[model samples]
Target: MTTTRRPGAYHCGIDAAMDVIGGKWKVLILWALDERARRFGELRRLLPGITEKVLASHLRELETAKIVRREEFEEVPPRVEYSLTPRGVALNEALAPLGAWGREHVIGGTAVTPGG
Candidate 1:
C-alpha cells in the first residue's frame, strides 16, 4: 500500500491485489464500509485502535484506489460520508470466502486470550 505501481508493473494478479490491500487496516476498513456509508466519526467508532491520522491516510489511499467513495454534503456543520464503490462491493464479495475460512479455522478453533 505504501508504493504505487505503474501500469503492467505487477508480476501477477495477486501481487497487484496485495499492493492495494497490504496494510493491517485496509481490508478492515473495507469491511467496515461493507454495510453502508459512514461519516468519519462513525468509522472511528467502529475501529477502536486506529488513530485519526492513520484512518485519514488510509481513507485517502482507498479513495485513490477507487475502492471507496467519499461524498461531502453542504450543511451547517458539514458532513462527509464514505462508502464502497461498485468495484469495492465486488471486492467485498470476493473476500467473503476468505472471511468464512477465517471464521471456520482461525476464530472457531483458536483458544481465547485474556480479553480476546
Candidate 2:
C-alpha cells in the first residue's frame, strides 16, 4: 500500500516519527529484531499474536523505511534474514523511555489488563 503525504501533514519531528512507527505492530517488530537478525518464521514465532500477513507487511514497510535490512542468501534452499539498521537501533533506543513508562504506569496500574 502506498501513502500519499497530505499538505502540511507533518508539522513537527514527532509527527514525522509517528508516521514511520505509527501502527500497533511496527514497534513490536522492531523490538523483536533489535538484538539480532531473524528469519520470517523466527519472527512469526517470536511475535506470537501477530498474523503472518501483518508481519510480512510490517517488515516490507520497515525495509522500505531503511529501518530494517533484509538479506537474501543464495543456497540450495533460499535463506532470508531481517536485522535492524542503524536507524532502527536508534529508534529502539528512543522508544526505551516510552516502554519504561508503559511498564511503570500502565502495566503496574490495574486499569490495563496484561496479555500473553
State which candidate has the highest lDDT. Answer: 1
Give the 10-residue window scoring lowest on summed lDDT in candidate 1. Answer: 1-10
| Model 1 C-alpha lDDT per residue in residues 7-111, reported as the tens digit of each score | 788899878888877788889999999999999999999999999999999999888989999999999899999999999998889889999988887789784
lDDT of 2 by residue, 1-116 (tens): 44343447788988888888888889999999988999999999998999998898889888888899999999879999999999999999999999999889877764475662
* Candidate 2, position 101, lDDT: 90
Q: Superposing every Cα of model 1 onto the true structure, what RMSD results?
A: 2.6
TM-score of each model, in listed order: 0.90, 0.87
Cα lDDT for residue 37, candidate 2? 97
For candidate 2, what is the lDDT? 0.87
On the 0 to 100 scale, the lDDT of residue 69 in model 1 is 98
TM-score of 1: 0.90
